[model samples]
Target chain A: AQSVSQHNHHVILSEAASLELGCNYSYGGTVNLFWYVQYPGQHLQLLLKYFSGDPLVKGIKGFEAEFIKSKFSFNLRKPSVQWSDTAEYFCAVNARLLNNYGQNFVFGPGTRLSVLP
Target chain B: DTAVSQTPKYLVTQMGNDKSIKCEQNLGHDTMYWYKQDSKKFLKIMFSYNNKELIINETVPNRFSPKSPDKAHLNLHINSLELGDSAVYFCASSIPLEGRSGNTIYFGEGSWLTVV
Candidate 1:
């Protein structure tokens, strides 16, 4: 089974601090990667996704993620995070089944980011 | 209008009770999903329906049932709810990502269910 692991469970940073959240997946084949964020009392929103060409994908809110196939990692980063960046971040992997019938999704436990203003 | 919406934004029920959460998507997506988010903020896919057909059914208990009247609607019905069932249930819809093999999901505001 495919599983996603996030390196940090909780991260606290002051405003304007550089941020990087490490994500790794245990899958051997072609897979789609995504980063989703959930603000307080809100639904999960798509931060970014990597499907094909670009290893470095830019998403909304000045966030970006780099997909490193060699290490099975897709890490989310921001040059400078603001207080509004506080949220729970989830790393997800979507892989096709061997039977070619359907796809499976594996989500990491999520990392909570608290950006102090 | 909201692209995806779930009814009963907040639900409080006692154990052994039955409840249902309704969902609808106006985005004309062919796939819909039910995801459970625990208190710790762990999100897990419980069920997924594509074009009104059951496609992905995770290791969820039989007490939880999902119904899709159409491609744009997916509803979840929970029976004999237990304390452990208290969590946030999210309804999502997705359309195939063009030129790619994957799909991009859109989530609803979610229904908070508290089983007492």
Candidate 2:
């Protein structure tokens, strides 16, 4: 039973503020990481994913996540965020082999970000 | 074209009633999954189907069952729903990530289920 923990439940900031959402998973084995965003009244959209690559993975809309294997963390970061970046962000993890079988996704309780104009 | 879609974007029913939600994916993905997003916005996998075969059945209650008629469709049926069953149900599809580039799951808009 792998579980992902997100410490921040809600974050409020103004436009241009730096953003970092912490995501830590309990799995110690090879795993795939993903960050998905859901805008108000919209479906979840992929921001980025880490299969096998550099620790620092860049995603859409100027977002990036660092897969810190030692800490079991893949924290999403953005140097600057716009008002349009306001959305509920989810961190998901899937064991490499289990994912290939059924693609079972275990998502974190989302972090809600609100950016003021 | 919509990659993944779910019918009855919103469903409301009384307790002890039976209801179903239908989902279809146009992405030609071999795997389809059902996920429940609780009120606290926690998402968990309920069931997963690969090419119409049940692959992962989470610890969800037996009252909730998922059926995949074909590779492209997955339907969820709930019998004698309870208030705790109220949540947003998401249908998602993804090709196996192994040896694949940028593997990710694409989710439908979600069906909101409310039990009175």
Task: Give the per-residue Cα lDDT of candidate 2 at A14.
Answer: 96
CA displacement after TM-score superposition, residue B102 of candidate 1 (Å): 3.4
lDDT of 2 at A6: 90
iRMS values in order, in angstroms?
Answer: 2.0, 2.2
CA-based DockQ, model 1: 0.62
Model 1 lDDT per residue over B10-54, tens place: 999999999999999999998888999999999999998878888
What's the CA RMSD for each of the models?
Answer: 1.4, 1.9
Query: Of the true contacts between chains A and B, what fraction does model 2 have?
Result: 0.73
The parts of candidate 2 lying over 4 Å away from their true place are A97-101, B99-102
Cand. 1 Cα-lDDT: 0.92
lDDT of 2 at A75: 99
- The regions of model 1 sitting more than 4 angstroms off are B96-99
Sliding window of 10 residues with minimal summed lDDT for model 1 chain A: A96-105
TM-score of chain A of 2: 0.93
Show the colliding residue pairs in model 2.
none
